[model samples]
Target: MTITYQINTPLTAKQAADIFISSGIKRPVEDLARIGRMLEHADILVTAWDGDQPVGLARAITDYAYCCYLSDLAVCREYQQQGIGKKLIATLQEHLGEESMLLLLAAPSAIDYYPQIGFEKLTSAFLIPRSK
Candidate 1:
């Protein structure tokens, strides 16, 4: 299987919104407008394609100096276990270089996976508003 990998920020809001919805990543359609704006501020957005089809996506929001958060990582279910996610993350790290903090919120099932990718468990506190 020949897959193409690219590091680009030209991804459109429609493309991202569609991927998020299709991948069941829990991003609501109502957020697409916000997401579109957010994408503009991203340091990098890497995508994997199978000859024109977007099969995976990984994005980072950063200051490009101090820290970067690896957000919106997803690979279509059928495309999992083929190293797509790893490739995406590795590419992002390359762009980050050294001296930058890479952070992410690991999905419950993926906690163990993050550690394997060089992320140690961090003890930090954050607040989320309760659902109304």
Candidate 2:
């Protein structure tokens, strides 16, 4: 499959929700409005497309100079293990400044995957649980 990457591409909430569901990412896919808001507020968004199909996505909020929070990284289950996720991250990094650092909170199932793609495992991070 020939996959193309787009940065800051306009994506409808439904398209994003579909990818989230296909990739087994735990998101509120049923709440498209919330998803739309997430997209609206992200500072960077990279998407992988196989023709018209969105097979992968990476969304982040960054200061462009200091730090970045990579909130989501996902590739469709059928499209996994093919370096799409890695490419998406690489694309995201290209948009960030050299001084900026990228970080994310991986799901339990994805804890091992990030390290394989060059993310350092950090034990010093902390977060307040989100109430939804």
Candidate 3:
């Protein structure tokens, strides 16, 4: 499919929202302003594109040495199951180097998917659920 990957590419909120909606990924896609803010505040963005179409993406925040919190990973519905998400994570890792740890909170529906792609689930992690 000749998919291409990029780092820190300028992404519009509409494009990100479209991918989030189409990929069935849970996010605040209904609010463009929030989406724009999310993209703006992210530390890193690894995006996969087919020419001009954003097929998959990974958004992360990292200290660039100790840990990388992978906040978002999404692939278009038609683009899922093609290992694009894996490639996105791998690219993100390549950008981070081996000194950092990559971590993410998986969607309930995708609980099994991450392990198959080499993500080690942790039981000790805790979260203060969002009030919104």
lDDT (0 to 1) per candidate: 0.80, 0.95, 0.94
What's the TM for model 1? 0.84
Looking at model 2, report the run of 10 residues with the lowest lDDT sum.
91-100
lDDT of 3 by residue, 1-132 (tens): 789999999899999999999999989998999999999999999999999999888999999999999999999999988889999999999999999999888889999999999999899888999987
The parts of candidate 3 lying over 4 Å away from their true place are: none
lDDT of 2 by residue, 9-70 (tens): 98999999999999999999999999999999999999999999889999999999999999
Q: Can you tell me which runs of candidate 1 are displaced by over 4 Å?
A: 128-132
Superposition-based RMSD of candidate 1 using all C-alpha atoms, in angstroms: 2.3
Q: For residue 118, what is the lDDT in candidate 3?
A: 96
Candidate order, lDDT descending: 2, 3, 1
- Listed per candidate, the RMSD to the true structure in angstroms reads 2.3, 0.7, 0.7
Cα lDDT tens digits, model 1, 1-132, are 788889983777777777777666765556777778767877788998888888888988888888998878988778888888889988888888887888888767787877776779987947594472
Model 3 residue 88 distance off true place after TM-score fit, in angstroms = 0.1
